[model samples]
Target: MSAVPLEAVVIGASAGAMEALSALLPALPQNFRLPVFVVVHLPPDRKSLFAEIFQAKCRVPVREAEDKEPIRAGTVYFAPPNYHLLIETGRSIALSSDEPVLYSRPAIDVLFESAADAYGPALAGIILSGANEDGARGLKAVAAAGGVTMIQRPDEAQAPDMPLAALAACPQAHILPVAGIAAFLQAL
Candidate 1:
């Protein structure tokens, strides 16, 4: 665990995102103190229903990230389909239509990297189940910025490539199962 008090959390996922997120997000208590930013690779052709779905299960507020929105504590913001979600230096949300990274428009790297810049050591970055290596570099950036970095144990993930890649890039990251990750967030 990080000694620095965390101010925000950034989570990235792909292939098995829905299942992994289901196990994680609903665990946060309604009064959880930090803002949570999530980027799950979604088809660029459709609108994201993540906010609607998670809002029904989570105690905290859940909504799609909107451009230029202020970051608020106890809220879960999911990137809209086709847009890269970024955290501004001013602690606000910024959505971008930048070209896809790793074939995904709402790239995990963009979110994690920008968040690391914005929150520095006050951030916690988590990599979950996914089939690609999109988040590896971003998790490394988080670590470089003195943020806490975590990855779901590869053996327990439905899609292990992402976690495995992140582990390789950031050997120091905490490796935990989904339930353990949830417990860590709840205790924050």
Candidate 2:
């Protein structure tokens, strides 16, 4: 892991997430180097076509996570519609039906916590548009673990609550507009 510069990147988004992700994913170039792990709030009990939608626009491969499946670089995984995706050693994922946090099954905290423990400072965590406080604590945990934290500027967010909560909780978070965020990730 020490040899990998940045071990992995994690992202959390909700509410107006679809729109925010649509912009960010397409901005990442083909052959982007790092692995990306994401958590997006979705209505449980309904299957999402998000993976397919993103796959078409993203240069990186995208898939719905399968239990115990190993994570891989240049590929994006969406937590199964009703399940929370968790991290494990070297690319593997764990699925859970445990109760929702902040009213979200695939809660941002779950993904951010697991990724923080797994990657530590080698991690980069991003919080985008949303309507709740789901990702705030998780982003804080990531920063406390020595990782870089980024939040979409509240003014630019389609739903500012999430980003505002995140900034309030993680004061050090780098607040950037959507396009600035896309550019920052590209530079990394």
Tens digit of lDDT per residue, candidate 2, span 94-150?
A: 889899988898999998888888887888889999999999999998898888889
Compute the lDDT of residue 71 as modeled in candidate 1: 90
Candidate 1 per-residue C-alpha lDDT over 1-188 given as tens digits, one digit per residue, 9 for 90 to 100: 67689999999999999999999999999889899999999989998889999999999999998999999889999999999999999999999999999999899999999999999899999999999999999999999999999999999899999999999999999999999999999888
Cα TM-score per model: 0.99, 0.95
All models: lDDT? 0.95, 0.86
Best by TM-score: 1
- Backbone-clash count (model 1): 0
Which number leads on lDDT? 1
Location of the lowest summed lDDT over 10 successive residues in candidate 2:
1-10
